[model samples]
Target chain A: MKQSHMAFMESGNFLYTLDRFKEVPVLYKGENIKEALQEKIVSTDSSLSIFPYGPSSGGMVESVYFDILTQGERIQKVSFDAGFKNRSIKLSGLSMGDALLRIERMNGVHSAAYSSMFCHIWEKGIAMDIPDQIKYLRVAMMEAERISSHLFVASRLTGGASQNIAHMNILLLREELLRAIASAFGHRYFFGVNRLGGISRPVNINGFQKKIRQISDEYREIFHTLMDSRVFIDRLDRSAIIKGENSSGPAMRASGIKKDGRNLHRYYEGLEFKTITSDGGDALARFMVRSGEIHESASIIEQALLHSGDLKPDPEVNEGSDSFMAGGFMETPSGDASMIIKVRDGKLESTGFMSPSILNMEAFAGSVSGNTFADFLFGYESLGIWVCEMGDFQ
Target chain B: MKAWILRSFRKGIITSKFPGGRNENASPWSTPPVYRKGDQDPYCPVGAISQGKADANRCISCGLCYPNYEPSMDIHGSVSSVSVPALKKSIRIYQIDVGSCGACNLEIGALANPQYDMARLGISFTNTPRHADALLVSGVLTDNMREPLMRAYEAMAEPRVVFAVGACAISGSLLGKAVSDTLRIDVTVPGCPPDPFTIMDAVQKARGVK
Candidate 1:
């Protein structure tokens, strides 16, 4: 009888072995590697294994499994097994509200972005008019979420270099933002806040604005301190290079892409917002981009708050269609997330989600190909790609 | 480095004095759902509440339960009073994500921050289950993850605690029948994703925090 066992390799590799039989390489991304290096692969029957769950991943979702072949301390070939974590998100036959709830769970932290995209797509299919204040509120919520998400990435990147103090400071800032969100909407993750046509409740700007101001001040001080640290800068500089159009969100902005979905939104037409860009296209660049976006997000929130008082109860409109299909694109903290929905006879027929993680994860393999093991960790933390978000597209 | 030290000194104890001091900052989800006059069926989109009884294991904390109800008025949270005999010395936890959406993981991650500072209570997160006294499992337990979860559990020494950390982990939430029902979970912390304070309280309690 042959039995299969999963094995964990050092750094970037995972293997499955058959008992008392030679290891058969489960080839993936096989064409990406050169023909000359294919002969260097080694097959072994017995190898030390660690369960490929969250423990070894430094608290990341255990959804991703990478298989790497290293040659003399350098990663020669890389492949991944991302199938083990796929959660089939079948939206057919469910009502719009229930569908949105399911989509929210696709990525816990990025729920608002997913819900907004889904609702936007569904509403547009029926061509429902949205109030200007509602758009502003959506943008405000996205910016707030952007701040919290970026802080988490920053904390992880800092923590990767053993800077626990810096990690804790950024996490503390993130907690403060989460508290503000909770105080305003009564939920930390912003679930159920983005309803079709308008927000579920009125905006509470004063308290949220005050918290954003304090967070900005504290963030500036702490970020400046982190920037001045030579060790931290050294670890991040020139690591994980995802140049040109290969990246998105801060990663793309860090690589000098001037594109941002906020510019396309009609509500942001008059708001004072600027897309920040960097030339490094490395880990430090991504980190700096996140730092810059904190300030930008804060400014956007301030502007949005100024107009929040003008929001009126959205006019009641019935958005019913016998057969309709609509698509939407929105800029999340990570990147552009696109959602498409098809409705027939007041029920969902099909839906598609293209989360930013798919594009970012594709770029990840190339970024870490030539880097060392330590740089791989830095690259992953800096990219801020959550495996959980990939279910919608995978 | 010097600046960080000075800043840390100035900040002085930012940690929470929880279960002892005022927990005015408890999360909204920490409170149970209440009945209102206008709330009809589907009070919760995920069906966390039914017939005025809230299932903590199924609630995602979307704040749709009682739209008019204010979470700040009432205070409810974990009792923060469990004393495991075997874990009195200290507890090292290992987290496993069977199939999560990342919220629960973040909540657990937040426990390490200064506010919660779980390390002060003799609880720490280990990178391997072999060194762990508790297996902190999150997300809905899918079939593919069952073997690995069992292997992780088997690796730990006897008298190990398995803590189900979120709604999906506790009752599979929306996944329903997809979640496996094998292991006998020792502790169940509920929420769409439980707050860091709640997570801290659960871990502390599991480690015999008085």
Candidate 2:
């Protein structure tokens, strides 16, 4: 297992120290990697032909370029340029509000994760403990977001299987959750909902939690039906197999690794947080882990909803007249996204974050290498790599 | 086949009453902003507000100026130069992401959901710009994607309109230059990421889809 790779290690921006870097670290330089990482892919095999997909295409949720090295059927390897939408967001010299604003926009699919992680790091840095009520509120928002994200992935898998009926149901569930989140937090993606010490707006957790549980039930029914479809299960069951030991998020958990950030977070212990894992490190296993987590997320939300108390927004963050680094990591909907910031003289001197999407993208590239060309989307979507999250700011 | 049909019909109508009137789906913060009170330069990051008039093109819907220039909850999605009067029947869209936070892409993609059912309005997403009637571009202009974004627009045939969807694409919000600065845009969808309803209505308006 890699403690860290040269990709992020040299930058010195990462919060976690690299005790032992992998001897042969995958020096993933974004767009171009196949040439170095896997020599087998760039072969002179007569049957093999390169096909480029995306960066500008329909059916893709975001802009990403995929270079498929294949023999018209089975793929020898796959290389992707997911950094096309990289805005290179550098949050240095911005106020706390501005930085938080930019953080939420980093990955709109899981804005809650980025913001909550920011807030978590900030609170830890300032040496202030978040109130128990605020903690539950934060946890509830994170879980709801996790449910939506997993639903999106499941929907993608079903869509790949051409299970239009099941796919539609999953999208319906996702939309319902989004609306419910908006109703509770005033914003759809929990933007501005999280503050340093408390949630910005008081949430009606009781109603929100019930709606989540109800959605979870409907989601389970749809997932169950999808599982019943042998074709759907077969398409992903033994496809794109990879060892998840080095992967992050559900990709890691799918391989039966019990290393979920929530498993260690003290706040989640009271909520009966458990790391859900599956046996096979295949797309189906990933799907199983996601499905199980959605239900678990609902249960966590239910427990968190018990303390439905109004929380006042924490006051504006004071700047450090004396500059010092303060940062930490938390389990986002994706994986452990760590953030470190230096505040000096009433200004945020600099900021850096390890957005889990980058690591997961690497995981996707590694897993999809030996699999057939057709298994590309299965392995890709299962890892849930938000391409826009790759460059710069976490 | 008969049982499939029966089961499909059993689900009943989940389609929304969009392209007609405002629905209950749009998030309050993601909607357009309208003026409320006196002159207050409450430091909008996007500079969406100037002289107390809120510009939807630049608004990211951050709600920094609450009470003064608050969320309008408007249904309309964008500000377009002109509608393609001939494209009233069916329109093919090719979406290009120059650089995005993923919200605009999701909101734009949301039009395909059962609730929106954009296909019902003769709208479909095409994989290639050659087959597209319009290009829906999201995110700010990133250096890496500039060429691909331009190439996509170039590949489109005549009567092809370009839509800069979201504050990022239209005005760059806080990221960088608007896609409109580089590419000629016919329509601009506001909000950090405009509500799908707003997008649906705007697309209809852009294509002159009665």
Maximum-lDDT candidate:
2
Pairs of colliding residues, candidate 1: B60-B192
Query: Per-prediction interface RMSD?
Result: 5.7, 10.2
Reference-based TM-score, model 2:
0.90
lDDT of 1 by residue, A210-310 (tens): 89978988888989999888999999998878998877788898898888888896657788977998999999999999988998999998888777753
| DockQ of all candidate complexes | 0.45, 0.46
User: How high is the TM-score of chain B in model 1?
Assistant: 0.86
In angstroms, give how far residue A218 of model 2 lies from its true place.
0.3
State which candidate has the highest DockQ: 2
Model 2, first chain, TM-score of 0.86
Instruction: State the weakest 10-residue window (summed lDDT) of model 2 chain B.
Output: B1-10
Error of 2 at A45 (Å): 4.1
Estimate every model's Cα lDDT from 0 to 1.
0.72, 0.77
